[model samples]
Target: MIKTAILVDGAFYRKRAYTLFGDISPAERAKELSAYCHRHIKDEKEGACLYRVFYYDCPPMNKQVYHPLLKRAINLGQSEDYVWANDFFKELKHQRKFALRLGRLAEEQAHFNIKPDVMKKILSGVKTIDELEEKDFSLSVTQKGVDMRIGVDISSLSFKKQVDRIILISGDSDFVPAAKNARREGIDFILDPMRSPIRDDLYEHIDGIRTKAPKLEKQNVT
Candidate 1:
């Protein structure tokens, strides 16, 4: 029984899930997420026990508006414009839509000013000739709290010897320091990026790295 704990960033997982699959079921998502951890168990730790899965996410500020808006924002299917003969401006248009929806949500729900702040941060200093672009603000919101939660949890678990191995399912670099500290304390740390490409820096430092199997892609559960 390999003792493993999975710390998942809910927002990261949800966005990736939607990208890889049309829609994701909670049950299936949990199953897939856990299974990915199981596969990446170090060969020597065959009987390690899986301790728990910790999922961190902000409660939907406006569930009614966020989901549909995010979906539309991410999907921008454009055909090749024979007139301009350029690659479909997919990411550009998608971000524009995302920014617009974020702005709407902010206005309606008294949340962050999605449009103005997003522009200030990601789309700043763009000239009139520049093509449209989108900015990723999801990570920005999660930066302070979520990273803290993950770090504290990992440290607590390691100090208490809660599990032999701890697995994190996120691509963010903020966890690197925590993971490094965990390694220094003799707790095995593994990185699971769900479906996103795991960066070399993260991969090199972890005791193990596992990605979702191709079978997960076939499930089409999202």
Candidate 2:
């Protein structure tokens, strides 16, 4: 059997899951993620075996920051998002053959910004800036060390021959270099974008493209 390592971009998976599967409890989400990973291993054509599942993500921000729309400082640690994220991470740790690679949020650079759609409306004169509300804004923060960690792991896996196949679950082109290197080492590199459209050029870098999970109907717009 071909040993396969499944690498997940946590932010991308979470967004896609929310869009396709709607809101679910953290424990349920973890179980779903494990099932999704296992589906790839059970592919009869590849005869893949489970090596490990590496999930890369940043811990939730737990700092106090001033909200421009609210005109007050908000403690992010007390937010429901923070609580849910912690719970989700805890649940993931309990899964077999699962490895969590946590990066960190650039807390000092964290700030609230208008949502992209809201900003577009304002710029196009469809909505006035004076009409902006708290709901139109969202906290923006940069994720540090995530891409680097992924790159390093890919290099290590390739050099050490830990797995014959590397299946990355991300849509970002930033991983092109790592994927190229892994392929050079004779590892079967596959890209799983979770049904999201990828650039035409991206096909040249991977051995295959596969998404085992079925997309569910979106229940709500959040």
Candidate 2 structure quality by residue, lDDT tens digits, 1-222: 899999999999998888767799999999999998999888748587989999999999999999998889999999999999999999999999999999999999999999999999999999997899988999999999999999999989999999999999998999999999999999999999988878999999999898975765455433
Q: TM-score for each prediction?
A: 0.57, 0.94
Runs off by more than 4 Å, candidate 1: 25-45, 63-144, 215-222
Q: What is the C-alpha lDDT of each candidate?
A: 0.56, 0.92
State the weakest 10-residue window (summed lDDT) of model 1: 96-105
Weakest ten-residue segment in model 2 by summed lDDT:
213-222
* Number of colliding residue pairs in each model: 12, 0
Native-to-model Cα distance after best TM-score fit, residue 158 in candidate 1, in Å: 0.6
Clashing pairs in 2: none
